[model samples]
Target: MRLKKRISPHSLRHSYATHCIEAGVNLADLQHFLGHQSILTTTRYTHLTQSNTDSAIVRINALMDSIHVDWGNVK
Candidate 1:
């Protein structure tokens, strides 16, 4: 798996963080996952796109629905 293109550790870390954000992972959890003392640092690593944001919102809504809690009303 050798190629002319070289990938840096920062690139991998940034990609992982971005994917996690796209997967609807909580930012605070991501911060801890990345071992960043400051959440701002974690934010620096993650790049958010509109599509990823929409998907994350959908996933979060689905999760909330699954928990039977919507606006403090239990279903």
Candidate 2:
């Protein structure tokens, strides 16, 4: 049997980590699941969390609102 695409064990591990982070799994629990000696290793998935993206969007919108720029006035 042959495969068209190459898939590595690490790819599955990475996917698990990403999904767990996005699903709001506890950091400590994730750390245990991944068998990492340090929590820092699991922290890499923090950037993939939906909450982080949502919070960033909220902050950007708030900043834009605070600026109150008038696009119509610009020539």
Give the winner by TM-score.
1
Candidate 1 per-residue C-alpha lDDT over 1-75 given as tens digits, one digit per residue, 9 for 90 to 100: 678877899889998998898787999999999999999999998776898878789989999778876699888
Q: Against the unseen true structure, what C-alpha lDDT does each candidate score? A: 0.89, 0.79
Which regions of candidate 1 are displaced past 4 Å?
1-5, 53-75
Residue lDDT tens for model 2, 15-71: 788778767789999999989999999887455456768967998999777765477
Minimal lDDT window, size 10, model 2:
66-75
In order of appearance, the predictions have TM-scores of 0.62, 0.56
Pairs of colliding residues, candidate 2: none
lDDT of 2 at 75: 27
Global CA lDDT computed for model 1: 0.89
Q: Alpha carbon lDDT of residue 46, candidate 2?
A: 52
TM-score of 2: 0.56
lDDT agreement of model 2 with the native = 0.79
